[model samples]
Target: MKYDLIATSAMGLESIVAKEVRELGYECEVENSRITFKGDELAIARSNMWLRTADRVKIKAGEFKAYTFDELFEKTKAIPWEQFLPENAEFPVSGKSQKSKLFSVSDCQAIVKKAIVERLRSHYKKTSWFEENGPLFKVEVSLVKDVATLTIDTSGSGLHKRGYRVDQGEAPLKETLAAALVMLTNWTPERPFSDPFCGSGTIAIEAALIGQNIAPGFNREFVSESWDWIPSSVWDQARAEAEDLAKYDQPLDIVGSDIDHRMVKISEENAFEAGLGDLVSFKQMRVQDFNPKKDYGVIVSNPPYGERLGDRKAVEQMYKEMGKVLVPFDTWSVYIMTSNENFEKLYGKPATKKRKLFNGFIRTDYYQYWGKRPPRDNR
Candidate 1:
């Protein structure tokens, strides 16, 4: 049976995530917050395996208006818990409320949990024998404008936990956000890509994986495996497809560097774990120390915004340093995602284009600086 699938993405990366879904041969109803599509269990598995920028994959069980606790309990009770969850599993309800009829979110959460527990107890024919403590089964309840919608979390620990970054440096870029930056570059495998302020080497690693067309889930395990109802053959099929899609022969120039030597070491280890050490290079150098060997390539970076690093003066100096390093590459293009517009003054020019992007709670601007390149004259 087809089920409604919701792929959760970061606030600014939603459009790119939706595009990635369409690329995978699925028609999605895209919105500002999330994208909805209809797929079976295999589709759900595929999404969990390949989606790079999504936060989680959810299976829509039921959605209805809940004006009171009784309505919430009754609607949640109707869900067939035995179909997806094992008897030994714990189904914990998690949710949010905003300008809704059920103003008390805690009360709503309790009611929903009670309903699921009631269903599970009835299904197993044991009032108190079923274990309430197992791997968590997440439930999402959204109370928006006084209407309630609910769904089941099929992807646990979020997709950002790519299972490679065991440690992080100061203000390291998130793997999902780094992947989104790589996507915004429109870079093919033919072009060079580099990140200078590559703390923990997230952008560099993500770019290398994309260039080689590696599945992000290759090194990771997923929560979908916990569902006893899905056949083992289906998961095997999905994994086989993932294995076949791995690419090792592509030549790519993906590189990352940081001022910290330890960060460079961490990046190398991460690449090794991802089986991409040979495809990516990590160096210990500051932005000023970098001099490109190639003329035209893509430079995508998330430099320190000075939030936890330093004061405003140091941030301005950092931007100035970036400007100096980039001034000579007329054919090259650069994209900087930061929360500061003072970057314009420091760079001594206005960006050709700016897009609104959010990095968690900090609203950011994605500034595209097109280096001076004379228009080609077609004779």
Candidate 2:
């Protein structure tokens, strides 16, 4: 059966997630942090198993405007929760409100919970209390401008937890964000890719996944897998398709390095866990020492942006050194994400293009320095 699905993303990556959804053959409506689309049970399974940059995939249960507690309860109860939530389903209500009459999030959550429970109680015919011993259906009630949108989480954990990267360095980029950075670049599998400040090797591993056409969620599980409404055969089919689509034999030319030896080791471990250890090379080296032997490579890094005073001076020095090392590679493109406002001045050259992105909650800019294409002979 077709369902309204919403793929949630980071604030700046909605378009990317929408593109991914479209690639999956679904037309999507992109909003601020979420992309809503029409899809069937298989589409939900496919999205949960393939979307690399989305945070979570949720089923849009219902939407309405409610100004008062009674209105909220009645409107929420009007939704056909029985179709989605089983009699014993453990559905917890999460809530968010903005610019709405019902501004108390806790009250909103409690009201929604009561409404759903009431609906379930009526549907099941005799329910003093639900067992809640079955699969989880995490419900979210979000209010914006007095409009409430209810959704059920299909992905139990965030998609960023790809079950890889058992360990990570300090301030490691989220897997979803790292995947977005790689997708934003023009790097192809044929071109060399490097991340000089690769913390726990997120970018490199994501690139390897991209290059090899490996589904990011292939090795993980989603909450919907346990939902009886979506037959297990649907998930089995999605996984089989993912396995068929992956190019395990594809050769990848990706490298990641970090100044800390321990981080480098962690990067290797993460890559190994992601099943791309042989495809990505990790090294213990500073950004200044990075010198790619291959011409016409791509450098995408999330370098250190000193939030502390003591580290600011050293980070600025490192930025300057990065300019010294990378500027001379006229044929290699460079993309760096950092929060420093004066990154361009310190790097000694203005970016060819810049895009605003958020690395977590901290606002940052993706400095893109486009390079001349390699000679035709190289191609």
TM-score versus the correct structure, for each prediction: 0.94, 0.98
Model 2 per-residue lDDT at 234? 96
Model 2: which ten-residue window has the lowest total lDDT?
370-379
Cα RMSD for candidates in order: 2.5, 1.4
Tell me which residue pairs clash in candidate 1: none
The sequence of per-residue lDDT tens digits that candidate 1 reaches over residues 114-161 is: 888788789888767666566667887888876787888988888888
Q: Which stretches of candidate 2 lie over 4 Å from their true place?
A: 376-379
TM-score of model 2 vs. true structure: 0.98
TM-score of 1: 0.94
Model 1: how far is 227 from its true place, Å?
0.8
Which ten residues in a row are the worst by lDDT in model 1?
Answer: 370-379
lDDT tens digits by residue: candidate 2, 77-161? 9999999999999998999999999999999999999999999899999647888999999999999999999999999999999
> Which residues of candidate 1, in runs, are more than 4 Å off?
133-135, 308-310, 371-379
